[model samples]
Target: MKHTVQRDWRVTRPSRKSRFNFDQTTALGGLTVALFTYIIYHFIYPLISKGLLW
Candidate 1:
Protein backbone atom coordinates (compact mmCIF):
# COMPACT_ATOMS: atom_id res chain seq x y z
CA MET A 1 0.00 0.00 0.00
CA LYS A 2 1.30 3.48 -0.94
CA HIS A 3 1.00 6.24 1.69
CA THR A 4 0.18 9.87 0.70
CA VAL A 5 1.83 12.79 2.52
CA GLN A 6 -0.30 15.85 3.30
CA ARG A 7 1.35 19.23 2.73
CA ASP A 8 0.95 22.03 5.30
CA TRP A 9 -1.18 24.96 4.14
CA ARG A 10 0.42 28.43 4.21
CA VAL A 11 -1.06 31.90 3.77
CA THR A 12 0.71 34.21 1.33
CA ARG A 13 1.17 37.78 2.49
CA PRO A 14 0.29 40.58 0.11
CA SER A 15 2.85 43.14 -1.05
CA ARG A 16 2.84 46.65 0.41
CA LYS A 17 1.87 48.19 -2.92
CA SER A 18 -1.28 46.02 -3.01
CA ARG A 19 -2.51 47.31 0.38
CA PHE A 20 -5.72 49.29 0.93
CA ASN A 21 -5.76 53.02 0.12
CA PHE A 22 -8.16 54.02 2.91
CA ASP A 23 -6.87 54.19 6.48
CA GLN A 24 -8.43 52.21 9.34
CA THR A 25 -10.09 55.27 10.89
CA THR A 26 -11.87 56.29 7.66
CA ALA A 27 -12.90 52.73 6.88
CA LEU A 28 -14.29 52.15 10.37
CA GLY A 29 -16.14 55.48 10.38
CA GLY A 30 -17.81 54.80 7.04
CA LEU A 31 -18.72 51.25 7.99
CA THR A 32 -20.09 52.36 11.38
CA VAL A 33 -22.36 55.01 9.87
CA ALA A 34 -23.62 52.68 7.14
CA LEU A 35 -24.34 49.85 9.57
CA PHE A 36 -26.00 52.16 12.12
CA THR A 37 -28.29 53.70 9.51
CA TYR A 38 -29.24 50.33 8.04
CA ILE A 39 -30.00 48.77 11.44
CA ILE A 40 -31.97 51.78 12.70
CA TYR A 41 -34.16 52.13 9.63
CA HIS A 42 -34.64 48.48 8.71
CA PHE A 43 -34.64 46.75 12.12
CA ILE A 44 -35.15 49.09 15.08
CA TYR A 45 -37.95 51.17 13.53
CA PRO A 46 -40.02 48.09 12.67
CA LEU A 47 -39.56 46.59 16.13
CA ILE A 48 -40.46 49.88 17.82
CA SER A 49 -43.67 50.18 15.85
CA LYS A 50 -44.70 46.64 16.79
CA GLY A 51 -44.42 47.45 20.53
CA LEU A 52 -46.53 50.59 20.33
CA LEU A 53 -50.32 50.59 20.63
CA TRP A 54 -52.38 53.49 19.10
Candidate 2:
Protein backbone atom coordinates (compact mmCIF):
# COMPACT_ATOMS: atom_id res chain seq x y z
CA MET A 1 0.00 0.00 0.00
CA LYS A 2 1.35 3.42 -0.99
CA HIS A 3 0.17 6.55 0.83
CA THR A 4 0.78 10.00 -0.53
CA VAL A 5 0.59 13.17 1.49
CA GLN A 6 -0.07 16.44 -0.24
CA ARG A 7 1.19 19.65 1.30
CA ASP A 8 0.36 23.19 0.31
CA TRP A 9 2.53 25.83 1.90
CA ARG A 10 4.32 28.93 0.70
CA VAL A 11 7.12 31.04 2.13
CA THR A 12 8.00 34.52 1.07
CA ARG A 13 10.57 37.15 1.90
CA PRO A 14 8.79 40.38 2.57
CA SER A 15 10.27 43.50 1.05
CA ARG A 16 9.09 45.78 3.85
CA LYS A 17 8.01 45.60 7.46
CA SER A 18 4.38 44.68 7.74
CA ARG A 19 2.01 47.05 9.48
CA PHE A 20 -0.96 46.09 11.67
CA ASN A 21 -3.82 45.00 9.44
CA PHE A 22 -6.85 47.32 9.46
CA ASP A 23 -9.37 44.60 10.33
CA GLN A 24 -7.20 43.36 13.17
CA THR A 25 -6.73 46.87 14.49
CA THR A 26 -10.45 47.45 14.48
CA ALA A 27 -11.11 44.19 16.26
CA LEU A 28 -8.52 44.98 18.90
CA GLY A 29 -9.98 48.41 19.42
CA GLY A 30 -13.44 46.93 19.92
CA LEU A 31 -12.13 44.35 22.39
CA THR A 32 -10.33 47.02 24.36
CA VAL A 33 -13.48 49.10 24.60
CA ALA A 34 -15.55 46.11 25.69
CA LEU A 35 -13.07 45.18 28.41
CA PHE A 36 -12.88 48.71 29.68
CA THR A 37 -16.66 48.92 29.91
CA TYR A 38 -16.89 45.57 31.59
CA ILE A 39 -14.34 46.60 34.17
CA ILE A 40 -16.35 49.68 35.03
CA TYR A 41 -19.57 47.73 35.21
CA HIS A 42 -18.04 45.00 37.39
CA PHE A 43 -16.00 47.08 39.84
CA ILE A 44 -16.72 50.77 39.63
CA TYR A 45 -20.48 50.73 39.20
CA PRO A 46 -21.02 48.80 42.41
CA LEU A 47 -18.88 51.24 44.32
CA ILE A 48 -20.88 54.21 43.06
CA SER A 49 -24.22 52.53 43.67
CA LYS A 50 -23.36 51.91 47.34
CA GLY A 51 -22.19 55.49 47.85
CA LEU A 52 -18.66 54.32 48.48
CA LEU A 53 -17.30 56.21 45.50
CA TRP A 54 -18.34 59.43 43.81
Candidate 3:
Protein backbone atom coordinates (compact mmCIF):
# COMPACT_ATOMS: atom_id res chain seq x y z
CA MET A 1 0.00 0.00 0.00
CA LYS A 2 1.19 3.53 -0.81
CA HIS A 3 0.03 6.93 0.36
CA THR A 4 -0.23 9.92 -1.93
CA VAL A 5 -0.87 13.59 -1.22
CA GLN A 6 -2.71 16.00 -3.40
CA ARG A 7 -1.63 19.59 -3.98
CA ASP A 8 -3.73 22.64 -4.54
CA TRP A 9 -4.22 23.61 -8.18
CA ARG A 10 -3.21 27.17 -7.52
CA VAL A 11 0.36 27.59 -6.41
CA THR A 12 0.84 30.22 -3.76
CA ARG A 13 2.69 33.29 -4.95
CA PRO A 14 4.61 35.86 -3.03
CA SER A 15 2.46 38.73 -1.83
CA ARG A 16 3.15 42.27 -2.88
CA LYS A 17 2.08 45.70 -1.73
CA SER A 18 1.12 46.64 -5.25
CA ARG A 19 0.52 44.85 -8.54
CA PHE A 20 2.92 47.16 -10.44
CA ASN A 21 6.16 45.49 -11.48
CA PHE A 22 9.62 46.89 -10.68
CA ASP A 23 10.64 46.72 -14.31
CA GLN A 24 7.63 48.80 -15.33
CA THR A 25 8.34 51.34 -12.60
CA THR A 26 11.93 51.71 -13.76
CA ALA A 27 10.84 52.05 -17.41
CA LEU A 28 8.23 54.68 -16.60
CA GLY A 29 10.69 56.61 -14.45
CA GLY A 30 13.24 56.56 -17.26
CA LEU A 31 10.66 57.78 -19.80
CA THR A 32 9.52 60.54 -17.44
CA VAL A 33 13.09 61.74 -16.94
CA ALA A 34 13.69 61.68 -20.69
CA LEU A 35 10.54 63.72 -21.30
CA PHE A 36 11.54 66.28 -18.69
CA THR A 37 15.01 66.55 -20.15
CA TYR A 38 13.61 67.09 -23.64
CA ILE A 39 11.17 69.69 -22.42
CA ILE A 40 13.88 71.60 -20.61
CA TYR A 41 16.28 71.43 -23.52
CA HIS A 42 13.84 72.38 -26.28
CA PHE A 43 11.49 74.73 -24.43
CA ILE A 44 12.96 76.00 -21.19
CA TYR A 45 16.52 76.38 -22.40
CA PRO A 46 15.49 78.93 -25.02
CA LEU A 47 13.79 81.04 -22.36
CA ILE A 48 16.79 80.80 -20.10
CA SER A 49 19.20 81.55 -22.93
CA LYS A 50 17.28 84.73 -23.78
CA GLY A 51 17.07 85.70 -20.12
CA LEU A 52 13.27 85.66 -20.41
CA LEU A 53 12.81 83.43 -17.38
CA TRP A 54 14.44 85.93 -15.02
- The candidate maximizing lDDT is 3
Summing lDDT over every window of 10 consecutive residues in candidate 3, give the lowest-scoring window: 6-15
Task: Compose the digit string of candidate 1's lDDT tens values, residues 1-54.
Answer: 989886755547754674567789989999999999999989888888998533
Error of 3 at 9 (Å): 16
Once fitted onto the true fold, the runs of candidate 1 whose alpha carbons sit more than 4 angstroms away are 1-22, 52-54
Kindly indicate the candidate among 1 and 2 with the higher lDDT.
2
Assess each prediction's global lDDT (C-alpha) against the native.
0.82, 0.85, 0.89
Candidate 2 vs. true structure, TM-score = 0.56
- The residue pairs in collision within model 1 are none
Q: What is candidate 1's local distance difference test score?
A: 0.82
Clashes of 1: 0
What is the lDDT for 30 in model 1? 97
What are the runs in model 3 whose C-alpha is more than 4 Å off? 1-22
Best-fitting candidate, measured by TM-score?
A: 3
lDDT (10s digit) by residue, model 2, range 1-54: 889775745546645556955578899999999999999999999999999997
Model 3 deviation from native, Cα RMSD in Å: 9.5
Number of the candidate with higher lDDT, 2 or 3: 3
